[model samples]
Target: MAVPVESEAPGGRDVVGAVLKACMLLGQFSADRPVWTLNDLTTASGMNKTTVFRLMATLVQAGWVNRTDEGAYRVAMPVFEIGSAALAKLDIRSAAKPFMSDLATTFGNTAYLMVPAEQGAVCIDLLEGRNSLVVAGINVGSVMPYHAAAGPIVMLAHSKELRDRWIKPGLPAITEQTITDVNLLVEHLDEIEDAGYSLSVSDYLPGVAAVAAPILGSDGAVLASISVGGRAEEFEGAALAAKIEKVCAAGARITRIVRAMPRA
Candidate 1:
């Protein structure tokens, strides 16, 4: 009887080339181009059509990709469901939920917890005020532009790298109030860091206003932000100042709670 052996590459390492090719195929999908065809994957991955087709077939069998009747492919529901489940399991969301609910109820404004993402900030959790006439359009999993919203701006103020990358020339205007000048935005970011919060009135939306504070981790790095937003009229004068104070305090408390959790 002859023994079977796994194939080896030039470096004498067992080749799991199929698995690697499958991952490369899946990585081609993105927010901008979520659907792809066999030719696209073959071109993007630099793999031959036969290899791409075989890997994609396996991925579709495993429910990782869905093949359309038109012969195109897209990431299947399982991928998104798994990603959502992972976000739901994060300790920060659990730590911030109570504080967010309290802040929303106390101010009658929507409260949000957002974490930094590759492009902007991702809202992980939110609580709507009982009397809120109109809730902030953002919900959990919303990705906000770094320059257009108070929550993301506060997160950007803490990091020199993020600010440099995000505040490039010709920033997009989300609304009439959005800061478009790079120099002025940098000055405002410095002010936000000094004030320990960012305040925005109709910066992202016409009738909405928000005040946001950053949550720091044990290493003194910003972990996330807590924001309270509502109608522009409600966030005025003494009441607005009070909401800012409360939001800052809640951020501090959530930070402490996050720091106390045992590391994995």
Candidate 2:
């Protein structure tokens, strides 16, 4: 039998080309384009038809991809399980759950735990409260931009890199209320950092409101954010004030927990 030689990735790192190809195929499936026929997938990936079929078949056998009755391909349940498992391993998520539950219960809104991502912030966990509607705003795994929502704003306010990216002129407005002006956004970020929390009204999503505070590591770096969000009307007056206080308290508590844990 002829032995196959491994390929070198950039920087002289040896990599399994087949595995990389499989991942490339998997990346094509997304929220907007969840299913793909073999022909379409081949064209979209710009890979040979036979290669696409073989990799997809391997993925199907491994339970990462599923073949539809009509011959289209979509991601399988195991992918979601793997994503959930990854989220579960984060110490911040484990530490913040109790506080998130309390915030949801107390405010009758939704409480969320978000971590900073390269593109923005990712909602890793969520608890819907007593008054949660059928469409209670963003879902778990939703990626929010640093310029828009409360959670990402906390991240942007705390991180110099994110702040630099955000202050660049002509950032797209997520909604009419989203701050697009660089000068005003700079002022807004300063206010959030000064107050130790962020409040947004109809910014990321219309008619939605949220308050969030940053969870900081011992070194003063932001590890994550805890937030509560609901209909804009609910976040007003003394009620809003109470929510802000609770959220900030939750964030502080989680920060303490994170600092005490042994670093991996």
Candidate 3:
């Protein structure tokens, strides 16, 4: 579980520390806590309050962030729009969208893009299913508690070592439905490992069902996962199996496409 935060001002000829610090400041905002005031940013970022304010002002001017009348900061819409457009052009997503879309349409299930976070998985983007019956309550950027969702397990199943390493620590209970005990979670992971996907009913939120498969990287390691979620009843027996198989196949396809492409 390495935390991959980007760009800490390279130690080369003439580094831009101020710019890098600002980037770090922006990155510090997490899913659990999105809104922050100048004081909060200054404390989290370890920069002076004046510097934090100035940086936030610059971000606001650039439409990357906004300040509420109450003086808390939030990510601005333009920044999200730019990021979404960029992801729309990512080759892996580009190639898999049609396939995933067809699968979602077939199952009428909500679909998501997930990547590994520090010992967890974070949903980055999502598409609501055509049917209202499919659960679309969780938004993009929601952090999936490792115990409940298919996406986390799918991404984790890539390495027994990685999974074993991550799962060893005590699991947290988000709801009464969450599996907090280590041995119980291991049993669930065993099935996930065997099946190449994870499926669960009402494991996180009551009445929410999900299936997820890992997206492997060029190194044959898990890079991300794609998942479909809905009501428990929708994912049972053959229906659940079909959804898992399609999503897992799509994940593998996306992985291969990513592996074939050269890194920037």
Give the winner by lDDT.
Answer: 2
**Which residue runs of candidate 3 sit more than 4 Å off their true CA positions?**
1-91, 133-137, 160-165
Per-model TM against the reference: 0.64, 0.65, 0.60
The lDDT, on a scale of 0 to 1, for candidate 1 is: 0.84
Output the better candidate (1/3) by TM-score.
1
| lDDT score of residue 116 within candidate 2 | 86
Candidate 2 Cα deviation (angstroms), residue 85: 22
| Candidate 3 pairs with clashing backbones | none
- Writing each residue's lDDT as its tens digit, candidate 3 over 211-240 gives 888878766787778888888888888887
lDDT of candidate 3 at residue 130, scale 0 to 100: 80
Clashes of each: 0, 0, 0
lDDT of 2 at 227: 92
lDDT of 1 at 105: 90
**Model 1 agreement with the true structure over 1-264: per-residue lDDT tens digits:** 111112332333575766655766777786668999998777777776887798899999999999899989999999878756655555988888888899889988889999998978999988889877565568889899989788999999987778767888988999999998999998999999999999999999998989999988888777899999889999999999899889988887777667656666
Model 1 residue 29 CA deviation (Å) reads 51
Worst 10 residues of 2 by lDDT: 1-10
